[model samples]
Target: MRVTGLASGIDIDEQVKKMMAAKRVPMDKMSQNKQLLEWRRESYRELNSAIADFRYNKLDKFRLANATNVFSSTVTGNKTAVTAEATLTANQVDMKVRVEKLATQTTATSPALADSTTSKTKLSELGAVGNADGKVILEVSRGTGTPIKLEFSKDDTIQSVLSKINANTDAKLNASFDEASKKLIIKSKDYGADPFTLNGEFDTGIMKTKTPEGNLQIGEPAKVFINGKEHNPAQNEMTINGVKLAFLEESGNEESVITTRPDGNNLIGTIKNFVASYNNLINTLNSKVGEQKYKDFPPLTSEQREKMNEDDIKKWEAKAKSGTLKNDGIINGALLQMRSLLWDTSTKVGNKNLDLSSIGITTGEYTEKGKLYIDEEKLQQAINNNPDEIAAMFGGTKEKDGLFQRMYDRLLTPLTSISNKAGTSRYSADPTLSFNEQSIMGKELTDLNSRMAAFSKKLKTTEDSFYRQFNAMERAINKFNMQSASLANFAGQ
Candidate 1:
């Protein structure tokens, strides 16, 4: 703010700028440190995300498969008529089922009504056209329960009155008028005994409402014979001991045989996916932990960047960002632990090939780090020939755990550790920004920021003092020149 050297003929502004530039060196260095810290934080966060994905998305599925054991169900007989499914407990379960009856809901229809008794017709017109009672009563019940009664009467149109009934009626019955059928149709919500029994005194003479012989649908539950035992239910679907059966249609002639077999292909897919995911995660971790660091490539200062083109700056930053996570003990230690897990012996349950190698999952060359490679043919052959053995490896013995369970536990350890160190956005306790905090690096960044802030404040104060001193010098210089000029003028006169 101090203009320099109007009378002293010295460009004080330029000189002051040169002096302040020196003073700015410390602040600029702190800024560069902050930028480097930002890069380091970004690296840690990316690693954390990768680790979480590997553990939660990949390991979690295999862990579930190991715990429960994998199995799939298929129906062979009359598949078009009846499809069946099974869960893990239903492994190797085969059964013959006959669907005797499919549950159906009840429906009742009122006889043809006068032309004026449509949805748009007035509600009060019911008294004039139908019965003078002007009351539309419906009685409904489900199963063998007590009957629920409802009555509706409004000064609105017939459609409005019906909507009110449909909306408010506890009977769970839907009421509507079909113009094509020329009848008021009322259908039960679901199938069950005593589902619906509607007896109302509408002017039967004016609007003769009666059930068409076959139209009267008494609610009926599903009936099926499983293994030659008749089972009746109020629903069409049921799950018994992991075997889920749904009665699609009534089968009167031949019984449908549903067989539940072990799905080796699906299990193979699951295992393959697990292997691929492990490889991808390990490769990334190894690369990052071993990434080369270029110490010469310090973060660029604004002044240094001003001397170079954008492309050069970008190239410089690439080296600067490298090795942010290189040789990090936390990450490297975790990788070592995970790698060791691949070589460890799996559970020795039921005299099975308990090692990952026995199942066609093996690590690549040592140079590839701990990346796993799967032999599809060998894995499938094992699954087909030694299904029980495969099951035993995933599904542990009565005493010990299985291979997948072991891996899950191992992955969980490092995952939890990394999470605690470089937490997810939601869980980070000390974030880099003072406004945000995460566990480890966040605290460091926060302290660094505090120091830089204090230093910046001091720099500002020093710069202000410099300007003030320069301003005073300029004033004195200007006053001395004016006095000298006056003396010269008096001497010449």
Candidate 2:
């Protein structure tokens, strides 16, 4: 409906080309904005993940010696089972214990194939001598002795088959069933005892059989020793080495407290964490910066336009991009550190020999924010220079100020405090709004975290979509530009 770029007397091709050129800018703008949003979202994810990791790392591990309410495995009939501990530690004392037991097992056998040739047939075509609803009589032959007759009922299931077989047999042959394959098979007590067979015909058309798989026993209860001291073992309580621990089966139960073991090097984790995190951020950003628009779609939703605007999206994109010539000391220092090698050359390299630079981490040019990139080279240097620092940067290697540490302090402290509060009871027909300082603050922090996460995700998706659209627009514009020039040439001719 609108016509402005092309002259009124211009060729129709020229007009089309002009229209395309005009559309290009808006599409590009949309793509750029979308990419910015994606980056922001990814940043948010990295930040949140760091925070969660920090909080969990703060929880120190303890041995089963510190566990509570440990029960005895002997209560059910386990003799070899020793006292188990819930915590991971080196000392222990008196503690309660419990026995772990399982239900009894049963077994049943099927009639042997009369042909002895050992041919297989479909269940539908299988010859029958047993009824579907009644018990079937099967003759079990071990060696050359008179065969033992065993009766199996329809009520018997695969789980109970083993117990049933043991009850009826002193012979060496074992009877088993496979539920999954639906086949009846027999095995000899000793190896190479071939030709052990069962003789019985299925009376009903359904001659299908089943086999069962075996499972290992659950480990004995863990031990618990509290405060470098000893305590009686109770259910879920244990003393491992010398740490006190308890395994509360229920969620949010104060009684179910268990100490965790500490992994050395929090700082390294902090830094490398950002690597994975930043990669995710890049993915989100790429999507937004070049997304395609749904031509027929409506304008932005009300919520979409509220927190983020077109301009805000642009600003974020600018921040994400580094100028080719510009540099920041913090980012640069991090990069320089990454490039340097810390460990000496050694043929006997293990976890200690593992340097940061060995990986593809280096510094390079980043156009989006005009900042130096930690490309393969710089990345490796940074990792090699001080692997611990790099890891700590990403919330690894266990530092208090790492990304995860900050995130955890910012997000979880208030939440836990509020959740722990014992609030006053309010009695009213309509719920009275009595806001506790701790509760309110906790809720606020939680809300902020949720909002930030959602916003980041939305922004990333939008930007990614925008970039795709932008690429399409660029192609269209290029095509139109060529067409416009071609038209002018044609008109001249």
* Index of the highest-lDDT prediction: 1
- Identify the runs in model 1 with alpha carbons over 4 angstroms from their true place: 7-9, 55-74, 91-93, 105-218, 238-242, 333-349, 386-423, 426-450
Indicate which candidate wins on TM-score: 1
Give the whole-model CA lDDT for all candidates, comma-separated: 0.70, 0.38
Location of the lowest summed lDDT over 10 successive residues in candidate 1: 426-435
For candidate 1, lDDT tens digit of each residue in 7-120? 667787787678889888888887888888778767776776677677666666776643344556677767755777665456565778888788777777666666655678
User: Residues 109-153, candidate 2, lDDT per residue (tens digit)?
Assistant: 343433422223322233434555455555656568898776655
Q: List the residue pairs that clash in candidate 1.
A: 110-209, 111-208, 111-209, 131-203, 430-437, 430-438, 430-439, 431-437, 431-438
Error of 2 at 189 (Å): 22
lDDT, residue 113, model 1? 65
